[model samples]
Structure formats: C-alpha cells, structure tokens
Target: MKNIDVKSFGAVLLALTTSHCLAGEPADAGEGTVFRSLFGDTLERDYGITVSGLVDAGFSRNNNSSQRDRNSGQTNAPVAGLADENFELATMHLFIDKALKTNFVPRVTPLPGPAPSEASFGFTLEAAYGRNAQQARTYGWDMHLGINSPGDDNPDKARRDKQNFLAIPNFAGTAYLPYAGGFTVMAGVFGSGLGYEIPPNIRAARNPFASRSYAFMTESGAVSGVLLGKRLISNDSMLLGAELGVIQGQGNLRDNNDSKAVLGALRWRTPDMQTWIDYEFLVGDSQNDSTGDIQTPRGRLISRDGQFKQQHSLNGWHRFDQKWSIGGEMVYGHQEGDGKASTIDIVTGPGFDQAHWWGANMVLTYQQRKNLSLSVRAEHFDDPDGYVLFPSSTARGAFNAVTAGVRYDVNKYLTLRPELRYDWFDGQDSARPFGAGDARNQLTGTIEALVYF
Candidate 1:
C-alpha cells in the first residue's frame, strides 16, 4: 500500500469527475491498464491551482505647484495622490486561486426542477501593496495606529506599519449548492457588490480611469462578511444576494462596534452579456471601536461615540455597439453627527445630526481599435453639510471633475494608459480641497502601466 498526497489526489479526483480517463479502456476497468499507461506521470502533476498578478505603476504631474505641502510632501489630489511630479507604484496584487466546479447535487429534492448540476468548491488568496493599497486598506486601525497616512501633513516613518507594506486584501472561499436552481455562498473578505469600477488589477476588472470618483472613494471596499447569492431566473440574468458583515469602511477581520450591518444587492445582465446593472444598500456603524474619548461639535476634541451610517448605490454599464460603451454610477451616503461628534466608537444614543452627500458620474468609452481604447468621465458630488468630503473645513458645496484618457495595449501582458483630469470646488467659502488652500481647482496629467500574468 502507498500513501497519497493532497495535490496528487486532487488531480486524480479532477480527472475522474471530468470523465477524462484514458480511452480504449473497459467501462468497469478496475484493472485499468490503459489509464495507468496514459497518466503514469499524472500523479506528479500540479492540480488546478492558478497563479496570477498585476503591477500598476505610473508618473503623475500636477499643474498648481503640485498643491503638495512643502513640509510633508503630501497632496490632497484625487486618486494618484503622488508628491507633485513623481513616479509611483500605484498598486500591485498577487492572486492564487482555483476555479471551482459548477455542478452540485441536492441532498434532498424539495421541488421538481432542473437536474442537479455538479458541485464545486474553490478558494482565493490575494495580497496587495502600494499607494492604492494605502487608500483601500481598512481605515481605523491603519489610520489610528499610523500604519497608513493618505493626506498627512507630517508622516512618522517609524510608525508606518505593514498594512501598507503587504496587506492581505482578500481571502475567500466559494461553494455552490443546488438548492432552488442553485445558490452560491462566499465567506471571507470579498470585493464590494457595488461600484461599476472595481480595483484595477487586470483588464477584466473594468476600471478605465487611473483616478477614481468621489463616490467610489467613500462608498465601499473589500468587506469581511458572508454573502449568499442565487439566480432568480432561468436565463441566469438576475441574481440577488444578502450580506451580513462587520460594517463598512473597515476591512480588518474584527468588528469595531457591537452593531452589525446588513447589505442587500440585485444584479441583472442581458442575455448577450453586453449590458449589466447592480444595486446595493447598506446600513451600519461607520465608527471605530473606541470605548472612550471622542470629539464633539465644540472646538475641543472630546470623547463621544458615533451613530450609524447609511449608504446606497446603483452602478450599470451598457454597450451601445461594438465600438462604444457607456457606464454610470450613483451613490448616496450619510453619517450621523458632526466632525468632532463622529467618533470611531459605537454610539447608542442620539446627540448628533445627519451629514449626507450624493454624487453621480458618467463614463463613455470607445474602442478605437483592437488594441486601443479611449474613455472620458464627468462626475459631480454635493456635500451640502460638508459631511463626506472635507469634514474639518467649514466648506459646504459640491465638487466636480472631468477626466479623459486612452488605453493602449502593447501586448497581452502589458497596457499603457495616459490621462488628464481637472477638478473644481464649487460654492465653497473657505479652504480649497485640491490645492495649497489658495486655489479652487487643480489640473493633473498621469500615465500608468499595468502588467499582469
């Protein structure tokens, strides 16, 4: 008798499930001479696991003295908040995953329906590092512990932590169950079901801009939760999901507050797969787990817990023709309390007001050639209460931005994108958000390269 390892066993099981055994063998070939002859080397072969990754790096130059703080060399610029004119590693991600089988048999048939499909189970582990990782990392621990500083005037080198160096953004397992038609269950940190623009890693992720919108920045990110989804129609065009999780904004494994969040989403796609839409709603606490010491509306920063937050978003994209496509997103988000009162701690009592913001953006893309594409985006966000944007400033107004870019695929593994963007601060009486406090608008030019396996 011989002992078998997990990888070798996995390969054997896959071959058996796929009915890919050697040909010219008896149906009941327990004495399998041909199988042994053809796959004698299979016992040493790697299983179905796959390895893929992406490298996103770029140089960005700003026009308004770069708006970078002279003392800290940090800018409040939008997406690629690089130091004025410098090259930066925007983001890098490595993924190890396996495709799960898609057929599952029901334990017990409760109703008459289509035949059960085979069951599949798979997992994904992904790690990311770079500036984008800094932006997407969980906010509370990273910010409070000084692990990351997005717009800090003075950064502490010693306190800079591993959250920005090597962050495990996603580790999820997926399983399929043949219940009513079928159900897919995912556990662990998963990308937000909202947003038309996903984290840019590969071409298939569908993020056309190097700079992101204000809505995308504030609405959602990788969430630590359990998600269950099912197809509601036979065409496989409609999907509905329910998510229960630790709350939004924070991506760490632990929940910050006693309050939990519930999220619901609906996704629809056309039969041709050219048009798709997704809507998601979430309500939960946005505060951290601070038990003591919070800020108030008063000039002094004190100790007080914060209230719950609510957010909803709709994102969709449509292909008008072979060469043209359009995408749009709308987001509405609100948090309870003013700047000082919005503590990271959980608050059960109501002593604050609601700060809200709503924003929408439209994206147009044209495939000029097989390897060349162009995209333009226009977005507007209104923060009348100065809630979601500049919390400390007395500014209350809207922000608008326009962006145009082109993507040129040099090859299957490499792409180059160059873009120009302009942002305007509308109806603000105080400090400007983009520049060095003296300007209301800023202009920037950026180019990035994405290399993937």
Candidate 2:
C-alpha cells in the first residue's frame, strides 16, 4: 500500500463518487466528493463560485393503507411533505454560490461563520427537484415547472415524476455595506424570510425534522422582490437583527393584485448564544388573479381581488444544556376576504365571512451522542373557518400532529433520519381525509437519507 500513488487514487475516487452518487445514495461514503474534491480548487479559486448539493430521499409507511388503495398512495393529509406512501423521491438540490468573495473552498474550514465587520458582495442560484418543489416554485413565475402532475399527456393522471418538479427556489444577489455595524441588501427571487423553517433544499436540510409541521406547510412560499437587513446591535455575546422587504406577494411570482405585500422580521440573539427569539410578518394583498392557469380541479383555489392577506409569527428557542434544548413557535394568519371551504390547501373564491387561522408548535431535541440526536415535536393548527389548510376533500377545519425522529450522521457526507409521525383531523365527521381519503387519523413511519457532496 505504501507504493500506491495518492493523487491517482483521488481521481479514481472522484469518478466513482460521481457515478455512485448520481445512481443512488452511498452507504459509507468518503468526505471528498466529485465537484468539491475535483473543482473545489479551480472553481472557487478562479471564479469564486462554490458548488454544493444534496439528495434527500425517504420511505414512509402509513398505517391506514389497508383502508385505501395501494395505487392511491398513503398520505398524511394536510401536511405538505410526508404526503406520499412508501418511497418518497424527495428533494434533490444543487447550489451555485458566490458568498463572501474572500471565503472559498479549502482543505479544512473552521467554525468562524461569515465575518460581521467585513463588507462583501455575492449571489446565489439554487435548483431543486422533488415533492417540496411544488411548494417552492415562485408561483406565477414558474408555471411550467413544479406542477403536481406528470407530463401534459399521460394515461395515469395521478402519476407524478421528478421531471415535473424542476424548480429554481432561490436566485438573488447581495451586497453588504460596512456602515453602522453592517447593512445587507438583497434583491431578485428569494424567500419571504418569515418562517421558522424553510425548504432551502440545498447544501442540507434547513430544519431538523424530516417532515414539516402544518404551520410550516401552510406558510407562504418564496417571493420576488427586495429585502434590506441590518445588524442593529452586534457583539461576541449578543446580536440584534432586523429586515424588511417589498414583494410581489407570498407565492405569487408576478404582481397579481394592484397592491404589493410587505414582509419583515426582528430577531434577538441573547448574550449567552443559547437563546433567540424572532418576530416576523407578511401583510398585503395577495389576491386579484383570475387567470385560469392557476386553477385546479378543486376550483379557483387561491387569491382574490381586493382581499388583503396577512400572517404574523412569534418564535424562539432556549438551551438549558448542550444536549437538551427546547423551542416553540406561534402563528396567526387571516385574510380580509370571505371565508370559504377549500378542497385543497389554497382557496380563492368567496364564501361565508372573513377567514381566520392560527397555529402553535413545540420541539424538544436531545443530543444522545456526538453522531446522533433525537427530536420530538407537537404541533396544532386551527383553520376554523375552513381556510389556510386543505390536504384532502374531508381534511378541513383544524389539524393536529405529533412527530418524533432521530438524526444520525453516518459520515461527514451522509445523514439518516428515521421518523414516526401521527396526525388527526378535527373537522366534520362525514368527511375523512386520511386512509387514502377515507379515515380521520393517520400514522406514518419514515426513514429519510440526506447525502451531501
């Protein structure tokens, strides 16, 4: 072994990694990947572009599958993710980033995150494909992409494929001005920056849970516009941050209404670095589009002219010990439009009165070992007026969920999350949205693998 060529072996490893990674997830993979190991020097050194990606897939089993058809697919109705039964061809993401000109790839990167005092300019372009892409699409902007169905012409109308979900979740440029602590301005298509969890779907999973909560599933998607953020106070111990933006409305890629939406956030990181709280909101007109393009078989399902929509949230977390931590989030959202019974998650047309919905969630996690951690979450969302959430025909009114999962780092480049989740509907007895649209409750067990390179 001492006589072997080290450099030649690395090249072989690069090629083998590329082929195996593309084909499927690796069981015990090496730290160095294809692009990062091969072009990590050239791309980052020459053009300042860092390329990274991850593939997250999972298999979920629903207890109610017996009451449903195998072809219909098992589902945890009302939850955006975890909707599929058996194997889920989850998010496959890629990122092309130029963040902080001076910082690029190296053999070993230390924990010193983005420096506060230094000014910088950068950009990010991310492409994602999977079930989550249906929620990540920039609304009107990417019509042909991220649709829920297969090709326009297919015998099985219920069939879906990765080809339908080629989505650009984020595309934006940024500039950091080194004045009064630091000011950052970002524009183009990016996130609303309002929620506790986001489907960044690049580099890695932004949230700990493999399956998202009802609050997160009902929250708005990416927006098109500009955002301005500043570090009001910054130090080694504490950091106070705030941001504001004008967008084309949450989920709406282009301007559907004559009016635009306003979104912002105020965050506080305590001196101990073990606790933080954030208050974020989005308020404005998101309706006014009558175009048939956005319609669904359920009916005109989203946005209405002159109806103003708003959502507000308060969330925080505190750590009592290195291994034990607790976090929670509260949300209140409503539209100044007539209430309506939704056949799907989004309802556009008018109904009885104004709509109102709210939700709360709590998460507790334990770091059992250096390479493994355990998490459990309890959440409830109320769509009393039959608005905000609608996963199945009978899945209306309110939603409740309990989830427990563990994350195991198999290696630097591989992660595995096996989760158990239970959900129930609190609506009409006559309508059942679970058990393949036949039962009132559902249990799903899932194992998700995240492979990064």
Q: Pick by lDDT: which candidate is best?
A: 2
TM-score per model over all chains:
0.75, 0.82
For residues 93-152, write the lDDT of model 1, one tens digit per residue: 777666554422111001223425866777767777665664454433333334344332
Candidate 2 Cα deviation (angstroms), residue 277: 0.7
List the pairs of residues colliding in candidate 2.
Answer: 287-304, 288-304, 301-348, 339-353
| After superposition, candidate 2 runs with Cα above 4 Å error | 1-32, 46-48, 101-118, 145-164, 201-206, 235-237, 291-305, 338-352, 391-394
lDDT at residue 224 of model 2 (Cα atoms):
78
Model 1 root-mean-square deviation = 11.4
Go through the candidates in order and give each one's C-alpha lDDT. Answer: 0.59, 0.65
Please name the candidate that would achieve the greatest TM-score relative to the true structure: 2
